[model samples]
Target: MPAFGLMPISYRAIGVAVLLAIVAGGAAALSWHIQDWRYGRQLADLAKTQAEALNQLTLAAANQQRAEQDKRLALEQRLQASDQTYSKALSDAQRDQGRLRDRLATADLRLSVLVDPSDADAGSGVSAASGAGGMVHGTVRARLEPAHAQRIIGITDAGDRGLIALQACQAYVRALAR
Candidate 1:
């Protein structure tokens, strides 16, 4: 070693050092870029998965709502049908009751005639009378105007009252049937 301004260095050693530095810097930059790209790709994949999951859940919710609406509509239709049936049944029952009332009224009119035909036909000249509670074995007495009886029957006949009495008996039986 002699006293010199600069230390003696070899050209090959300088070239090797320069080459090593360049290689090391390039490797470090490439590793950093690769890591950034990997992280960005991972974030993108995660966002895509979240969006797909959200879409599926929304579709499922819409399907459930549609099913519920269908069920509600079915229930409403059933209720309406039940109401119509009930109303018709009630109307039919009322009509039956009215028919029964009318039959009973007709029966009552016939019973009144059989019970006291004399009072019913008092203005018609023929007075057919009978006693109460003696309808089956009762006697009917017909008192007619002589002129009227002669005009209708050709004779003032009050003795042949058995036919009239048979009519009264038949009327009583008809009333009972009603």
Candidate 2:
């Protein structure tokens, strides 16, 4: 006699239940494996794309650096040429000034300035040779002292050098701008 009037369990039912469970587990495992393989392939492709982008960036940077270096070199060369040209001009001016000073020191050259008759003394400024309002009588021209003439030359020489230096600076700026 049964306690609750229930039917007895069978071996066949138990076997069928075990087989279904195994099939379900196998299907789930296969699905997980396929998903893992797809994810791995996607990751590999992403890494490749990143590597190619990095390579392109590196090449662009290198080319930009090279272009900048070349431009700097060209500017330096132009500046050097300008410097040489100004240097030569300054040297020539100095040489010519030296020759003129030598001539003045030797009495071969005389510096003179034009004078107005009204501004000059009538008796003293007019030489006895020919003072009747003539050029030879020192009415229109006055001879400068040697010391004063040398001082004037010195001043002019300094001015010339300053002008040359200013020109050189301007050329340097232009080269840099280019």
Candidate 3:
């Protein structure tokens, strides 16, 4: 109510306001610090979870690639084995053909074919030529000359080789299908 009383009361009110303001500012700063710590923990947990998922994915991809590589290696081994077997067969055929040709050249063997009796050159299923010395059956046997026999053998050799090559190709296709 008096001017002197107002001065003392106003001083006391100003001191209390300053103390309250300090306390409020401290409380606000503490709340912000707590929130920052909690949010930081959540962010770290999310990052850890993502890293683990990525690691698992990488392992799975590596395993799949390894399995594919193993399968390819097995296929290559099988193909190589098949190729070797086919190669052996082809060589065996060639050796046999060579022996047969040698025998023909030495006259140890002769080539013959059945001839029709109605033909002027045919016999009664037999040929009494000096070089021909084999019994004939019901069909007239006609002996081919060395040159003609050699040509026939060559044709047969070509046919045999072609068949073997075809069989090799078929086997290769079957292996791939599996």
lDDT of 2 by residue, 1-178 (tens): 5579977768898888888888889889989999999999999999999999999999999999999999988888888899899999999999989998999999999888877666666655643233564456544666889999999999999999999999999988888777
Off by over 4 Å in 1: 1-23, 102-178
TM-score (C-alpha, index-matched) for candidate 2: 0.72
Give stretches of model 2 more than 4 Å off: 1-31, 124-139
Which of 1 and 2 is ahead in lDDT?
Answer: 2
Please give the CA lDDT of all the candidate structures: 0.60, 0.86, 0.83
lDDT of 1 by residue, 66-177 (tens): 9999877866666566556555555555565455445444553122223354554556554445557665544445543433433433221222244444544554454445
Off by over 4 Å in 3: 1-24, 117-137
- What does the lDDT read for residue 161 in candidate 3? 87
**Model 3 lDDT at residue 98:** 88
State the RMSD for candidate 2. Answer: 5.1
Model 1, position 152: C-alpha lDDT score: 38
lDDT of 3 by residue, 1-178 (tens): 5675654558778889998999899889899989999999999999999999999999999999999999888888988898898889889988888888888999999987866667625545454333344554445666889889888888888988899889889988988898
- The clash numbers for all candidates, in the given order, read 0, 0, 0
